[model samples]
Target: MLEYAPAPESRSVVQIAPSYGLFIDGDFTPGKDVFKTINPASEEVLSEVALGSPEDVDRAVAAARRAFETWSARPGSERAKYLFRIARIIQERSRELAVLESLDNGKPIKESRDVDLPLVAAHFFYYAGWADKLPYAGFGPSPRPLGVAGQVIPWNFPLLMLAWKIAPALAAGNTVVLKPAETTPLSALFFADICRQAELPPGVVNIVTGAGDTGRYLVEHPDVDKVAFTGSTEVGRQIARSVAGTGKRLTLELGGKAANIVFDDAPIDQAVEGIVNGIFFNQGHVCCAGSRLLVQESIAEQLLASLKRRMSTLRVGDPLDKNTDVGAINSAAQLARITELSEIGTEEGAERWSPECSLPDRGFWFAPTIFTGVTQAHRIAREEIFGPVLSVLTFRTPDEAIEKANNTPYGLSAGIWSEKGSRILAVADKLRAGVVWANTFNKFDPTSPFGGYKESGYGREGGRHGLEAYLA
Candidate 1:
């Protein structure tokens, strides 16, 4: 077999500090304790990060509160300019940020460079334009900013998720205290420098880094007026209970087990490609990844063959390698979860398969995988694996496909692969998911709204809808 020669993005683009501190009140401050964040691709210790304590959260919220008074008092146009400046700075420093993201997050550098960085900048640019036009955003004639937003983002898409929550909240004139996921804290910390360069007001944005307890401290802090989270549904439930009557506006983008339904009439080649992109992109760490494949029985065999062939071709190696298609799993714990779930799939009588691909020995890794003969009753088909694993099930009719697709509690995102426009429209409307795509998978834009239904959580992010959550 012909092999791809190593073509790695230079690591020199990013400069990692030996130790990091919490960004509170527009400055880096010492924390009570600290932890190390490692590069998952090489298992190399990237940097030491402060483990934020409740006191740290306190300072962050207090800073946000103090800044909120003046921040909320700023003219919408002034806030827009700040957001615009931040957006421009992100573009200028994107290469550094992208390299840092790949090192810390274990995602392929190409994704961080091409998809994640561009969208991160676009989101800021999108919300910046909305800063001065909140009254016309359909929220109300004179919408108001909810003060001191507390945001918790997941490790899957660190910088992009930060942009999703912070851009809108800041644009709506609310200051923020954000806790980036413990595994991916470097990029957010680097973003603190971008804020300094933009000369944003002190306390306008604060980043506290730590594990679950620190996140709990930030979200449960009384000073927070709004709470936004993107992570597992289990934690979303806990946040809902904590904020039950706190009067804090909340939005949660949780887990998903989306179905990519490919009909018999669908183009075989395109459907195979979409299936790969849907489930394997970002190693399937996405919240709205199409983990479930619902294919018509008539074309099931053909689709499986094509999908296996394509999956075999996916390169899994060094994240910095430009030719690598898939990279390392984010962490050892996440890899264990994927491994356990995949083992259970085999024990439960589902046929498991993976392409003949060798993985790196030094760090966490998993080959692209799929489960055939899967039924909805199987746990692998029902639960969110959150890895590069796909569960394939067959259906005879469009109604059957929709039935299987909407059967789960998750309603985050789904896709259809039929060329027929009428069938696509009808099936999409009935799938009970927040976002549906036809003939494509894993596409995102700043102008479009994205969210989920049912246990996948509530409220929308992106476009005009995103501004509503931050505005009162």
Candidate 2:
């Protein structure tokens, strides 16, 4: 094997200001309190960001509400043009934004550049085409935009999530007040700039940076007509409770403990690749990560061997390095949670394994880890371990595999790997998850609707269904 030297992407492409203010009504406004956002890979403070106080939330919502009357009244063709302009600007600045996302969110530069940014641009492009065509979207004759939408996104896949929330809302002619997670707020601020460059209407899109309190305030704000959130199931529950009696329409893309099933007759190589991509992509920060591996008893030994061998070759280091595979954990708190859950897995009698890899001295990092001898009762198997951790369990029959896979409260996503079409169809039909992948895993498209059922939360976030979230 050849060891390649470091080829780090230049950080000079992005110009980070010393501090940032909240984006409200097409302008940057100062906030009462401010916090520093850091580079998760190096633990260096990238910039100080304003924390939106309750008053700040009120102001932003007021701005959105005021603009919604005029913005929503605009012809769908005009809305489409604005969205297309934003999409073009995103494509032009994709590299710079991808680099900024890698720095802020600790995802490998390769993924940020290849997967995240392209998807972000594609989402806007897809939704942009839908703006003028909503009448035929099967949502009734004249599907109308909901007034002001308050969207809250997580730190993982920060910019992509922002695109998911903002694009659909704007395309549907609704104005937005979005809150990016505190840990990775830079890209959203950058997105505010993109809106400016496109000359988007004032208050059509506003970004307020802050912690959970700000999100709570935005969700509770009486003026918001719709609320969209993507994060932990626990936090999703809180948001659900808060919006319970309010007439605000709600959509949540929350947590998952997805199962990746491997059958005895499956193609071993492809299945192994699918399994690795399922759990290890984005350092397993995915909400729909395939954290549980349900393999047939006959192939358990061979599959585990292949999985471990493949994991050993993964490069875990600087996020900005073009060759890096896995990168740092998004934050110290998330790293602690992953560590504690892995500890509980050991205490609960599950076997743990990781490749021998040296971690950097600074920043948050968790190696690719997998647990064997895991049972349905184990914490690691049941809980949403939103990190680079996988729990391996074996089943004897297709029925048993289905039973074990559906045993959890989560129903976000699942994967089935089998060469036999009949068995793949049968197993997929029985899985409770909203999204199922057969022979392939971790695949996403803007046209395909993505969401979950049961404790994983409700409502879809793509395709025609996504338009329903922001539409009247």
Candidate 3:
């Protein structure tokens, strides 16, 4: 059993206000309905965040609409300067941002600082260069902004997701009214403060905090020219249905149950590490998490034993700790989903194993679990169990691996591990996922385009491809 130690609370490095309000027109405005954001790791009420209603959505949309006229008309170089300033400010305040994100989102402080915040800044810096180079991006005669963009981001990677939505929208000359998830709205509220610090123009970016209702209002609002959402497949489908007749541009980055395939010829140790990273990173709250494991029949038993031993040693605990590997589950609702799916795995006859780790009594937590002897038809294999759970299956040949990998409705990401160059290329070419990692998993960069296929939803989020949803 992994030893339990009470994780230390966030150090008083930066002083934050007791509550946060909606950020509109370069200022914070209080909303009518206030909601409390809890720290998922400790079940501690972090802060009260104002929830924006339909009326608030309308007000934010108006603010965005007002900003668009002048903001979009400004020279690309001027916009680039603002982006540069924001990037610098983000770097300056990265430590505070990291601590706040870990407190609010249940991800480890290391990941928030090393992975999320750095990428957030890199995204802004990368997109800033594209602001003045849109004409060269092969977008025909004159690529123009689509006016006001309504973006709804998930709680998984709160501030990073916000950056993914806002950076591209603003770079393409569109103003934004963004809605952060209710459970993790604090970092975004703090982000609005950063924008003010950067002297970003009024109304260029507005933040509205609320739950699903606010997201629905933003999407259905007639004045919203574009909609970008990162959430569940069900919600993505609903948004698609809602936006069908409106003619509004829409981009959805939804769910995934990615397949991480290991061939007989692959380097066993490296493949094992990749397997560990594929499913367990960020407690597997990632949309592109490699939840399915397809090992070649020749090495199936060996790989399973290796993976189980590795999973046994994973240090699952508080998010604030730098040494913590798997942190707390995002919420109680997510914990229920993970529990239900894990039970289903056992009911379906797959052998389940979780480390004997002691969890804090006050918070939502789940042990890193692995299910062996899983068939493709199993619920744990087909459904996206967005927690630290791995479903392992065996495949006889390359054809079988490809067949099993693409059998799901989701096509967000896939992983291929093989020593042979030809085999890696062949398998990668056949996978239907938007992002394929050959001999690696969960690799991200600001220049790489990421999205999904089929039920996983559509549109890309990074690189030049990300600009499509924001342009006419």
TM-scores of all predicted structures: 0.99, 0.99, 0.98
* Model 2 per-residue lDDT tens digits across residues 197-225: 99998999999999999999999999999
What does each candidate score in C-alpha RMSD? 0.7, 0.8, 1.5
Per-residue lDDT of candidate 3, residues 321-416 (tens digit): 887888889899999999999998999899988877778788898888899889988999999999999999999989999999999999999999
The whole-model lDDT of each prediction reads: 0.95, 0.94, 0.91
Predicted structure with the largest lDDT when compared to the true one? 1
Worst 10 residues of 1 by lDDT: 1-10
Candidate 3, TM-score vs. the true structure? 0.98
lDDT, candidate 2, equals 0.94
Residue-level lDDT tens digits of model 1 in 238-301: 9999999989999999999999999999999988999999998999999999999999999898
